[model samples]
Target chain A: MDKKIKMRAEGVNFFYGRTQALKNVDILIHANQVTALIGPSGCGKSTFIRLFNRMNELVPDTSLSGNIYLDDLEINSAQIDPVEIRKRVGMVFQKPNPFPKSIFDNISYGLRVNGVRDANSIEERVEASLKKAAIWDEVKNRLNDSALKLSGGQQQRLCIARCLAVDTEVILFDEPCASLDPISTAKIEELILELKKDYTIVIVTHNMQQAARVSDYTGFFLLGELIEFGKTQDIFTAPQDKRTEAYITGRFG
Target chain B: MFTTLFFLGLIIFFVGVRGAKVISWEFLTQIPRCSMTQGGVAPAIVGTLYITLGAILFSLPLGVACAVYLCEYSPKGFMVNIIRISINNLAGVPSVVFGLFGLAVFVKFFGFGVSILSGSLTLGILALPLIISSTQEALLAVPQSIREASLSLGATKWETIKRIVLPAALPGILTGVILSIGRVAGETAPILFTAAAFYMRGYPKSVFSEVMALPYHIYALMTEGVHPDRQMAIAYGCSFILLFLVLSISGIAIIIRQKQRIQHG
Candidate 1:
């Protein structure tokens, strides 16, 4: 089976000032597929994912050389506004960071910022996004209550709903479940699986088991390089890189 | 510290007891007469309120904007570091020096004369560094992650600051403003050369009009008046009122800060 490429990174070398982080990295993210980047700490997995939305550029003295394409459009080009690129590619952080506002306002903030001025449309989109993120029933009655009042799991889901409200084509999860419990983690994993039918998803997880369970394509990253990339079954059963096999088999990180 | 509180309490107790004798409904409502030893300091009270309110009107927006620029927009470099240090140093400069500076700029150069406009502008400048530093600290207290979340949702830098950062920092900023009000209300130096009148016939009708103020009223009565005992009594009354105003402002700010801490926790 052949999958259409949604995002492609070619020879993407990233630097923080003079220190290089990603060197000669290349990967193809398939449309409507779950791609999991698994690696130990400081392996540049998070950095690699942030490149898609150009989030790294927000940091001063950071530079990237190479092409990151969202479909046929080169996202890293000077002509492309980073804000416009970010609108299409949404991101959820490692920790749940709901705005200090009402649940309804939190979800609608992205819509409002993107110039969705009609009140009815904003309300409908906020509800639909919450429902899609599997958090509507828990928060429907208290949509006006502060988002800070919600539990950790609910806040994470609310963050996801916030991302969904913007009508993004690709959603980036940066170790989203790192701060969650087993039940919340399971809920997130299930939601990611459900989401892959409609939206392209990229997740960076420290949990190898989570990658094996939820991802269609698995990329094992080690020390700023893509050690292996293939179908999850093959990567788990027959990894081409010895480092990937050793890391997966519990030999070393 | 206990000894310090003991003396402070002693001073407040004596002033409160003695000042209560003169503080009547008529005294608060009526204007001063007979070299300010007969009636009330009503004009002075009104002047203090106008000058303080004017100072806040001028300073709050200017200080908060400067703080937002420093915290949100200014790049971290040698220049920013120098700016931060300069602001801190501005806070430490003598209030009397600020008074002279205000006299030179607002009174002489701007031709505001010794009017409420000149006084308030001086007090506003005096309060500025305090407001900026405290506001910057408040903005910094907001987590960097919230900013990233807003940006990830494609909100512009100004949007995030206006919608999220500013609201989150408001309680702290308000606390700072209230504290600045307390300082501005009791300050004798800045208003001395710029705005305070030795004696005024009526309440100030405009910012350009000269006005009487509590601190300056008390100062004039105690030092320069003919009837020492009578003038000293009125001065004590003015001191009591000033103390009450400062303490209540501080009380409100403390309550607000406490509530914010509880809400955030």
Candidate 2:
């Protein structure tokens, strides 16, 4: 089967002041597929994902070298606005971070910022995005209630709905289920599978089985390096690198 | 904590007992007569209100803007540390020195004269450090995740600050403003050389008009008036009114914050 590349990172190196966070890494994310990055803590999976939407720029004294492209556009180029890049590539963080706003307003916040002004269209899109995230039925009755009042799982899904509201082509999930219960994590995994029909997805997780369960492609990161990248089944069953096999088999982090 | 509250209660009790008899409607609404031994402190009350309002008007927007620039826009480095140190030191500078600076700059250089504008400008400068530091803390208290969420949705830095950060930090900022209002309303030295008329008739007609203020009035009544006993009682009355004014302002801010908390939650 042939798959088109949605995003490509070529020889990317990231630095936080004097410390290196991501070192000489290269990967390709395919269209309409879920790519899972798995590693122990501080293995640079989160750092690598943030490069896609230029979130690293917000951190002072942090620098990056190399090319990251969305389609054919060099997203890191000086001419490309981070705001414009973020419109195309959205993100969901590990902890559920809904703005301290109403449930309806939380979803509409993205649309409003992206210049969706019509009240009717905003309401429709908010409804549609909520439905897509599998959270509409739970929150529809209390749309005006504060988003913070929702359970952790619902808030996470609402964040996903917020990302979806902006019509982003790619959605990056940085341990989206890290703070969730088992049931919530399962619901999110199911939702990610459902979402792969339209949006390209990249998820960073500490759980190896989660990567295997939800991803088409999987990359194993070890100490700021991409040790192996292949189809999820092949990476789990036949890792090309020794480090990948050891980490997957729980020999050591 | 008990000792602190005891002393606070004692001071309130002393002031209220000494001045409660003189705090009638006429005493609050009428101008002083017979060398300030009689009549009301209406002009002083009006002047304190105007000067406090003016200080807030000048400082609130500028202070919030400065804090946003420092916390959000400016890159953190040695220079930022230097700037922060300078601001902290500015807060430590004596109010009397600020009064002198106001005398030379606003009163002499700008020719604002010994007027309400000059006093307001001085008090505004006095309030800036408090407002800036508190606002910076408030901005910092807004979790970074919320900002990232907004930016990830294509909101610009300013947009995120305006919509997310500022609103989140507003309660804290208002608390700072309330504290500054109490400080500004009670300050005597900053207004001594810049404003605070020895005795004024009616009320201030404009910002350029010199006016009586409560603290300076109390000071003058206790030291300069002919009838010491009468003036001392009136001074206590002025102090009581000033305390009431500051508390009411803070009370309003507390009410606003409670409403905001309820709405956001």
Candidate 3:
């Protein structure tokens, strides 16, 4: 099936105290297409992504004026529970947070929390999710080992597997491989490419090549503004904006 | 210099061992009977257990509840700050001052009147500050990430605390309790004015019954026109038993803590 608009954000302005974190940001994330938000540190790429899942609400003294649509649901509405929104729009953190549990338990945690009681079903789902994360072969044997004992790369994959196990339709990653080694980063990049076939993926990263390599539609953000939003090939090769050109060409943030 | 220090330590070690050997197994099992001064300390042994157990039961719940309230529920406000400050000051007030307070409050007003109930209440108050401090430390040591992670996973705040936070902090809290037990086991001053009568020859039958702990027995046997050798022997035996009890409790606590840590880590 062709990619479709899975979620949308319209005319969103976000502030941390008096300082503006995001100017008017409008973007549409399509199903089964990896959209990477690329910018310098503190340029609102991460802040914009955090809006969709309401992770930004955790910050005290922060305010938002916007409308975020998760499929047909109004995610930004006061009536919606952020926790419920998070279940649908699963987030993988900057650091690999594997829950200090055994590998099997870490994957099953989301399912268990959502009241998935049948052991047989949980086992099958955990296995399928791990395979989707491309980590089942490496970790399947030591399923009972503590997640902390896994390598950083493995831990990141385990987190992806955790997100998948919850049966989320969309996945948000905030610098998911920023702390990993190049090899581990490459593995995660590969995993990301594989994941984009099934789930709507939104990622915020500082790495330009990663944005170039992994994304289908790329949104170039600068100074709390969306500078360019279009196909990745167009953004990387022939960006319309002068700022996007300067940024992708290794000039300045 | 090394030899001088070593020799002094050696002498002390040998002296302690000799005392322990002299105050051996027979001293532990037999109920204290002062042949003119109570050669054994069985009554003192029983009294110490009663007071210590009662004090622990009273203080543990109160202290932990206060700590959990402070850590989880209390906002940073004037009342909370004042209560915290008062607890800090209470810890610094002299034991003798606590003794006097116990005398005025429990002994005279409540009519507990030189009984284990009054003594236990006084000791519980003494141990409360220590328990609160340690429990606070333990609760703080639970990583904030764990709580955030739990909450993020759709677990209610109460569920997160019940399942994740409490089990993790349990070791530190137990360590604190065991340490307080050691201090409570050795206390004499506060109980002297509150519960310890002149000379309790046997174990107390009820909470209100006047009790004789090892420390009180030790104190009285040292004075009050008693037979010098037998009195001194009983004191030494009681001291040895008290030391063993404290050490054993601490040792067991450490072992359990280490086991839990290894299992978790």
Candidate 4:
């Protein structure tokens, strides 16, 4: 089977005011695969992922020079609306930031924003998305309850359900499990693998084990640079770059 | 906090004890008679209500919109900082200065005249800085992560603010409004030149009619009336009524904020 590219970034460079955060880099995210980015703190992994959905533009005084494509469409072009780009490429943050609203509203929010106002269809999509995120069984009876009342792990899954409700082609997880306990982390890892069969995923994580366990392709980043990129198995067992090997072997972060 | 509460209680008590005798049902319902020494402060009460309501109606939407624009859409840098500083400075400007501005602009230039329309516009201007600053604070308090979540789901910036950010910041915004109501009701200087009549016979016929307000009425009763002792008592009653009106308005706002908090939680 030939793998197709879902997203591609070419010669991407990013700066926050005077400080360069991402050096010239190239990466490809394959369709229906989990691509994990592993790096230490401040390695620009999060920055790179944010660019996939144009999330980096939210920060003031930040600029990017790159060709970022969702399939064949250049997302950074002036003709493309970031709002439209974001609908196609959703994001789940490190922290489970649920709106201080009811569980139903939280999931339906994306659909409503995308101009889906039919009550019956919204209800159907909400339930389908919740089930897809594997949180429906836990929250089925309390859809009207405040999303904040859910546990941290449940909230993270609800966030994922929120992304899924939008029917995004690519979902970016920026350290989605960084704040979760081991059990919650395991649940999210499982969900990611399950989600990959339907949606292309890009996750940034500090846990090498997580990257190795879930991702088909893994990219290792270091100090604003792409240090290595290959198949997860090859990158872990036979890293081509010494920096990637040293970091993977726990020589130094 | 106790000290503040004690002073508030003492002031209310001091006025209530003296004013209780004058505050009959007739005092609230009847028009003033006997050269402002007899009858009720009905016109003053009605006038104060109109002006305050009008001020809120004028300022709330404009202030909240300004705050939203400044916080969400404006490019963050020198220009925004300057605008922020100017708003803060506007808040610090004396009420009398606003009265003069109202006298010159809304009264003279716009030809609204010295009536409820002029006074309300004056008080609205006086309240704008407070409302804008409070609203800005409220908007800023909403977590950026929530905004990111909304935007990531394809919500436009306006949609995010209107649906999410504004609702979340509502309690804080109401707090600002509550404070402004208190100030707008009690303020004598802003309404003195632009709105308040010395003594009106009946309820204002329209926004064009000059009306008597509680604060200015109280001031008039003490200084302008012939019967000093009787007028002094009436003034106390007016003060008490004014206090009650401000409290009730703010009470309603507080209740709204409470409901919002409960619903959001």
The candidates score, on chain A by TM-score, as follows 0.98, 0.99, 0.98, 0.99
The Cα local distance difference test for each model comes to 0.93, 0.93, 0.84, 0.94
Give me the candidate number with maximum TM-score: 1
Model 1 Cα lDDT, one tens digit per residue, B1-265: 9999999899889989988778888777789899777988999899999999999999999999999999888888999999899989989999999999999999999999999999999999989998999999999999998989998888888999999899989999999999999999999999999999989888888889999999999889988978989888888888899999999999999999998887776
Model 1 Cα displacement at B109 (Å)? 0.7
When summed lDDT is taken over every stretch of 10 residues in candidate 2 chain B, the lowest stretch is B256-265
In model 3, the runs with Cα more than 4 Å from the true position are A1-3, A117-125, B1-15, B35-39, B77-79, B100-118, B193-211, B248-265
Give me candidate 3's TM-score against the actual structure.
Answer: 0.85
Report residue A17 deviation for candidate 4 (angstroms). Answer: 2.5
- Candidate 3: which docking quality band? acceptable
Candidate 2 similarity to native, TM-score: 0.95
Mark the 10 consecutive residues where model 4 chain A has the least summed lDDT: A57-66
- Tens digits of per-residue lDDT for model 3 on B116-191? 9999989989999999998899889888766655555655566667666776788889989988898898888889
- Provide chain B TM-scores across all predictions: 0.97, 0.96, 0.88, 0.94
Residue pairs with backbone overlap in model 2: none
Which of the two, 1 or 3, has more lDDT? 1
Per-model DockQ: 0.81, 0.73, 0.35, 0.77
Model 4 clashing residue pairs (backbone):
none
Which is the better candidate, 1 or 3, if ranked by DockQ?
1
Candidate 2: deviation at residue A237, Å?
Answer: 2.5
| TM-score for all models, in order of appearance | 0.98, 0.95, 0.85, 0.96
